[model samples]
Target: MPQTSKIFYQLKPLLQYVPSIEPPEKRVPLQDKLFWTLGCLLVFLVASQTGLYGIRIGDKTPDPWYWFRAVLASNRGTLMELGISPVVTSSLVMQLLIGSRLLHVDYSNKEDSALYTSAQKLCAIVITVGEALAYVVSGKMF
Candidate 1:
C-alpha cells in the first residue's frame, strides 16, 4: 500500500466506531427560486439577488465606497486578512494530519472517542460562526 493508503487503512476501523455526524436536514427545494433565494440569504444575509451581482467587479472610479464594497464582495479575501482564514485552512490541514497519522486518535478508548467528538464539534462551531461573522461584518451578503 502507498503510505497514505496504509495510514488510512489503520484509521479506517477506528472511524467506523466514532459515531456518524450528520448536519441537520434542510428543507427540500420546491423547484422555485424561493428556497434558493432563502439559502443565498442565509449565506449572505444580503438585501437582494440583484444587489449581489452589482458588487462583483471592483469599481474603477475613485469612490470611497468602491473599496468598501469590494472588500465586502471579496469575503474570503477580507477574512484572509483578518486571520480567520488560517482557522479554516488549518481545518483542512488537520484533516490531512488525521489521515496521515500525525494526529492519531485511539478510538478503542471511550475517552479518545469523546475527545474526537468534542474536537469535531469545536471545529464545526468555529467554522460556522466565523463564516457568519465574516458575511455580516464584511457586508458581503447585500
Candidate 2:
C-alpha cells in the first residue's frame, strides 16, 4: 500500500531540477557567517515593523489565532505577517509525519533526503497560498 507521502516520491524528476544555491567553494569563517546572520535578522525585524501596503488604520479584524503569531513568526499587518509561517507549517507537518512513522526518511540516501526537502518546499508553497486566500476571504486583509 502507498503511504500518504507517496505523491512526493513521484516528484523526483521535477525536484531534481529545482535550482539551489551552491555551497561556498571555500569554508566561510564563523565571524563572517555570524555577521551575515545578524544582518539578516536586523533586516527581518525592520520588515516586520513595516505594515502591508494596502492596510489602513483602525481596521481591526477578528484574530482567533493571535497566540500562534509568535510560533509562526508573523505580525498582524506587516510585510512579515506571513513571515516564514508557510515554511513552519509545512515543517511541522513533516515532523508529525516523521514522528508517526507515516513517512520514512532514509537520510543515508542523498536522493531520499533531497526528495523530503523538496516535498516540504512544495507543501509550504501550497500552504502559503491557502493561508493567504483564507485571510483575504475572512476580510482580515484587503
Candidate 3:
C-alpha cells in the first residue's frame, strides 16, 4: 500500500470513534485533497529555500564574507562558528532542567494582580539570562 493510505488505515480506529454523518474517507474531494497536499509542500519548499539562503549569506546578496567576519567578531557567533554540537547540548541541558522542575515557580494561593505581573517579569528575566548564559558557557550563543 502507499504510505498515505497506510497512515489512513492506521488512523481508522480514531476515525471510527467520531460520530459524524458521512464517513471520513469520502468527506473530502480528491481534487481538494491533492491541492491541499501540494500547496502545503510548495509552501514548505519555498520557506526552506529562503531560510537556507538567509543562513548561508545573511542579508547581503553579494558575498558571505561579511557574515563570517561578523560571526568571528562576536563571542556568541564565535561559538556557533565552531560547530552545532554546543548548541544542541545547551538546549538539552535547559530542557532537562525545566522538565525536572529545577526552574519551577510557585504561584499557588497568590492571586494578587501586581504579584502576578511581577512573577511574569521575574520569569522572563530568569529565562533570558539562563538561555544566554547557557549558550555562552556551552559555546553556542551565536
Which candidate's TM-score is highest?
2
Task: Report the C-alpha lDDT of model 3 over 1-142, residue by residue, as the tens digit.
Answer: 3232233344454444433333376578899989999997776445434432124424334533446535433212222232223334445654464477554323353323223233334444455566557746985222
* Candidates 1 and 2, the one with greater lDDT: 2
TM-score versus the correct structure, for each prediction: 0.35, 0.77, 0.25
C-alpha positional error of residue 117 in candidate 3 after TM-score superposition, expressed in Å = 1.0
Model 1 collision count: 2
Distance from true location, Cα of 68 in model 2, Å: 2.5
Q: Total clashing residue pairs per candidate?
A: 2, 0, 0
List candidate 1 stretches off by more than 4 Å.
Answer: 1-94
User: lDDT by residue for model 2 over 1-142, one digit each (tens)?
Assistant: 2465566678877777655556699999999999999999999999988877788624676766678877778887887888788998899999898899888777887767778888888788889889888988898463
> What tens-digit string does per-residue lDDT give for candidate 1 at 17-63?
54554654886557755877878666653332223333542434454
Give the alpha-carbon lDDT of every model: 0.52, 0.80, 0.43
On lDDT, the candidate that comes out on top is 2
Candidate 2 local distance difference test against the native: 0.80
